[model samples]
Target: MNLSNSLDKIKTFKKVGQVADNLGMETYVVGGFVRDILLKRPCKDLDFVCIGDGIKLAKAVADALEGKPQISIFKNFGTAMIKMDEWELEFVGARKESYQNHSRKPKVEAGTLAEDQERRDFTINALGIGLNANNFGELLDPYDGVKDLKRKIIRTPTDPDITFSDDPLRMMRAIRFAAQLKFDIEANTFDGIINNAHRMSIISGERTIVELNKIIMTDKPSYGFKLLFVSGLLKEFFPEMVALQGVDSVGDKSHKDNFYHTLQVLDNVASRSDSLWLRWAAIMHDIAKPPTKRFNQKVGWTFHGHEDKGARMVPGIFRRLKLPMDERMKYVQKLVKLHLRPIALVNDKVTDAAVRRLLFEAGDDVDDLMQLCRADVTSKNNNKVKRFLANFDKVELKLQEVEEKDQVRNFQPPVTGDEIMAIFGLKPSRVVGDLKEEIKEAILEGHIQNNKNEALELMYKLAAKKGIVNNPDK
Candidate 1:
């Protein structure tokens, strides 16, 4: 089970051993680097734990490198970092951690390698690769982490309750790993996370979002989200998403589980693109459905105006999650607002005018919107899904054709409001606004070409309707 070849990848590991020997320290590459090495997964971040002064050992290794790598030292934390080719290598002294019941931050004391490993969240991550002069390139596995890795399992190195209660964020990290690696959480560990789910309140919103985003970026984000839901962790921070879980039945009518449907959409989008925001749009496309859901005798179920409502909720949700409130937030909001537009087009006539308005509203995000809509069509009936997909293909083709003809993917109205005001000999008023709307509608409706001359002529005709006279000279 020796990773003899894996050792060859770390050229500086031997140098680290020599340096640690010079400083009379015990050091090992620990945490994710060790875990990933065992899993044969590529990792660009390395964490080194030293039983003695890690900073001194770091400096010695820096001097031993061929070019004498620059060491960035953090005195307070007794940590140092060196950026190797394509890898960020970090050095920290072995320390035992004792956490207060109320805070995730632990009181740190310099300790042995065993103590450092004891504080780790998972057994696999607690594995270490020895870099001591006596045992360079040797792996030290106290928890049988290699066996757990082979089984594709995630289990805490220590007591699950104690480990997770100490730092509830690790609970999230555990689920994230399960999703990212497609590993099953060990029985006791999974139950502990569910039992101690309420303890996540101590974790900050920003930190929670970071772990959540990592889960979302995984191959099957729904795997992580389902774990989050089952563990009750999602309800602690993101109740809105959790609220989208069940179906409401009235009379003989029921709605599909929007929660699982949304996750399917997210997975579909993940398969197509790695754009984080686009996947986010998939997650949020029906966020308001629960609040807007209704059952009627006439209609089976209706989430009327849910798209617009979901869009409005984006900023508030982003704020609570401590996600970016800038353009990214706006992008997600725009997608949510328009998530149903493409479907509506698919359901009805694929008019050039309708597609043009969609293109104008979606702008650079038109393609992403279409993708979200395609994923949104999740039906248990295969034929129903196929029919919707066929219609969607038609809508996409129509959109493409319209875009090629009119160049209105993000097209602006050829006539500006200022031009409207000047031509009508009017101030910026309702009359002016009315004319502008008419001109834009005409362009979108395909009644006239999207050119300044045609718009101006139309504008004049509309001005006559408004009883405004254009100055002949001007």
Candidate 2:
């Protein structure tokens, strides 16, 4: 098949072909760019594989361009890169790879394009389009990749076992592609993943997380996660999530399977927001239920303090999964901690103090926290779900009223520790901290407005009780 007409969209392909012809090198646009072109997906990056001297071909392509795009050469990997207009173009010599039993890194040697195609993780990715003069735009499919693409199937070019055993990260990629493309993983290929699940230990956490994050960012993240769980690959690194599986019962009183519940929450969050971290919070919201579970004759099953325990587990999980340990991790932790707060306020006499405290604690992330909580309402009874949603709406209305009246979202105290120290002629001490805490508590409890004058007056009353004289100038 010819892609000559399709190549007109980006004339760079013709230029690349001309340059390859001048340099007498066999070149083809290979891998993801070619696959996306065939699939009609929007792609800005292109990968080119040449029979010989990829760096030289890259430099030539750069020269052929208008402004002479700067070429970056990686001599070790026999690859080069160029930024051409809005496109990122890469060049690599066709090579075969041999992996050791202990490592995913492969020993590379120059090989034919056929050999290179054989090394691709998935058959659909192995499709290539010629960029040489004689066979420009010709489709090269050694493993019938185009047929697999048409069938909407993910299959390895080689033996699935050998393919996964060679680079176990491909197992994650198969599921990620299945989710992103809305395709099915071939049964044999999927079974290979389940069979070689333990080989994932050879892959690094950082690499695994990149694929996992991609899966989470897809339209329905739960789809990929289900595949991960079924394949047994999830247990290799994330046993905490695996621990959430199974139903416990004592004389016909069984708790809901938290593993499936978390997936429902993840899908709910994904439908509402594209934030990967928020979706992560949904995944972790009930992670500690297994540990904190208790059965009572009076209450059936209770997962008391699971939110707090789940929040505490976030840091260690992030550390283990090689996820960012910065404020992003903290955001997920905070959401996990505050997930049940709004639900707690659904009682008959929900107070403004509760809403104010939630505003102060959640600040700007209150909306995301509410989103997660609403998604957490996966009860089988429609009436129960409706009631929870209605209460949530009431809580939201009250929060708005309280916030408009008392302005406490991300609230910094009008009274500071330094101000307390200055007012009482004291250095930083327990008295300053105590006064500050009292002022904040008073404002949150609606006893006093969140203003400096009111806080100042309260400070004087508290300071007098402590036998400290008010010395404003000090």
lDDT of each: 0.88, 0.92
Model 2, TM vs. native? 0.98
- Residue pairs clashing, model 2: none
lDDT of 1 by residue, 247-312 (tens): 878877788888999999999999999999999999999999988987767978998999899999
Question: What is the C-alpha lDDT profile of model 2 across 207-228, one tens digit per residue?
Answer: 9999999999999888899999
Kindly report which residue stretches of model 1 are placed more than 4 angstroms away from their true locations once superposed. Answer: 1-4, 347-350, 418-434, 463-474
Q: Indicate which candidate wins on lDDT.
A: 2
Cα lDDT, model 1, residue 80: 96
Best by TM-score: 2
Residue 221 C-alpha lDDT in model 1: 96
